[model samples]
Target: MDADVWTERVARDYDTSSTHMYAPEVLGPAVDFLERRAGQGPALEFAVGTGRVALPLSERGIRVAGIEKSEPMARELCGKPGGEDVPVTVGDMTTARVTGAFSLVYLVYNAITCLLTQDEQVACFGNAAQHLAPGGRFVIEVFVPDLQRLPPGETARPFHIGEQHVGFDTYDLVNQHLVSHHYTVEAGRGTTFLSPHRYVWPSELDLMAKLAGLDLIERWADWNEAPFTSASRSHISVWRKPPSRTGTL
Candidate 1:
């Protein structure tokens, strides 16, 4: 499918369904990690969808701007309360001018996978580096691919939910990418969403960061700073722009 068409379909249902889609509840912890390391400086959110973390983070008094590629998603964000205050540019993250240096630049909700290629993903890190002040950090939230641990016939795994609508995500792993089929069924309505993502190893992401002149500073299984272990399902990785350009890692 064309990227434009795929984006359009997501734009329409984003607020209604996608916003509430992710489970294991990581937003609070992700934001909290940023707050602790971000200092009192400004922030830049890459996708800024529906101002999910942006609005709440801004309400906490963090100055924030965003680079949002989808106009419809930006428009949806603008309609929310306090949404008018966030400064967002509707353009591609790879080359978009985010304006002003920020102490923190974050792309949450596994948005980095939206780039579809390693080159594009690496470019995004470069773009983030260009907009960061010295000592600023870029934080990324993503799920580690678990297919290698499962059997060949296994595709679906029961994911997060309390007790209500049980959910499962089925994946087709080919090459280094995963074609995800997410199905969550409620009492009456059932939703199935397709998400095709390029899965990256933690070491590969670190290399990408290094290429952009950033160094891996921290890695956590959760935002609460849980130790990164093989059993961890997701990761919040933080990279720092060196305070001084001594070029020493």
Candidate 2:
């Protein structure tokens, strides 16, 4: 599917289908982590779709701000309960000016992969770094791709499972990207959706952090501080900016 079309359709159903599905469960721990690390002064959320995390964080008096590229998504956010009060700029996260040097800047829910290019991903790191005060941190949540799920030399992984059972499984692995097809059958009807995603190794993100002049501070398999080991499937990685060399001058 075309990117624009996918984005447009996603903007409409994002809140109802996905945002509401996972926000509270994810955002609760995420906010707590940021507050503990950065003292909850000010924060910038990249791709603050439908105020899923932003609204809850703002309610904690964190002085949160957000950047969003999709106008429809922004509009949908503005219409939510308590959402009108949150300050969000409608622009690409990599190019938008966040105004203040934030104590914590974050991108969650694997939204960074939406950029779909190494250059864009690198620019995202630079932009996040630029928004940080000295010693500030950037936090990201993403899943590490599992090569074991893919068949050799094939970009497609066909898979099917549901809340009840597994019907089939297939994965498409292509040049650092993964797409999954999960098919569901119910009442003599079958449905399928292609969920496209880019999966980067954790080490690659650390390198991105280094190139952007930030250093990895901590990594967790989950928000609850589960040890990041080979057994883990997802990660919450934190990187901190080094203090300026001229501070003593």
Candidate 3:
């Protein structure tokens, strides 16, 4: 499914189903990291769904804006407390343009993979760079593709299994694509959701950032600034637009 369709379908349950992402243990470090990078200027989120991180970041006195492809998801954010204060542009992250340059631009929770093509992903990096002021930072939080977990012939792997929810990823090795499948159960009823994504390697993403005129500054295994090793399941990467470029040219 495309971003709009899948996002609208899952917006209602997004917060609840992804409860672990919002827990203070998981969210605190992310907000802390972004707030430090924000440096008294505004920060922009590429997919600010339901104000999960944006709300708290704003609470810390940083101005926050967002670019969201799904109106339903934007509405979900708007309905929450402090949500109206954040201006959201309802459009694709690859091409959306908000009013002012931001000191920090972020895309979290593997949202970068939602762009199902290499070109789109590259364009997203360019877009992020376009929104950043000189020396501004862009942060991305995404999972490292774990093909090792899949046996020779297996195309799918279970990532989460709980009493109320089950989640897995199905891979298309040839296309470098994956579809995350989620099934949430409530009172004996189950609902399934599929979100399509294009998995990108770290090297490929670095090239994309370079093409967008961004330079890699740091990469970590998590929000806590842990070292990124081969065994790490995911990464939090930061890139900076050079101080020379003042605007999108």
Best by lDDT: 3
RMSD of each: 3.4, 4.1, 2.3
CA lDDT of each prediction against the hidden true structure: 0.78, 0.74, 0.90
Q: Tens digits of per-residue lDDT for model 2 on 1-249?
A: 123533655676555344333556766887777667667468889988888778877887788888988777788788888787777898888778878898888988777776767777888899999999888889999876767655577544433234522333234444666555434444655444455556678988999999999999899998888999998878999999886776510
Which residue pairs show backbone clashes in model 1?
none
Which parts of model 2 are misplaced by more than 4 Å?
Answer: 1-8, 19-25, 151-174, 180-195, 244-249
lDDT of 3 by residue, 74-191 (tens): 9999999999888889889999899998999999999999998999999999999999999999999999998988999999998888888889999999999999998888777778
lDDT of 1 by residue, 1-249 (tens): 124534655665665554354432746765677777677999999978778788878888899888887787788788889998898898888889976888999988778877778898899899999998888899998888776667768876655453333445566566566665555454666666676677777888999999999999899997888999988888989999987575422
After superposing candidate 3 on the true structure, give the runs of residues whose Cα lies further than 4 Å from its correct spot.
Answer: 245-249
lDDT of 1: 0.78
Of 2 and 3, the candidate ahead on TM-score is: 3
Clashes of 2: 13
Clashing pairs in 3: none
lDDT (C-alpha) at residue 121 in model 2: 84
Pick the winner on lDDT between candidates 1 and 3: 3
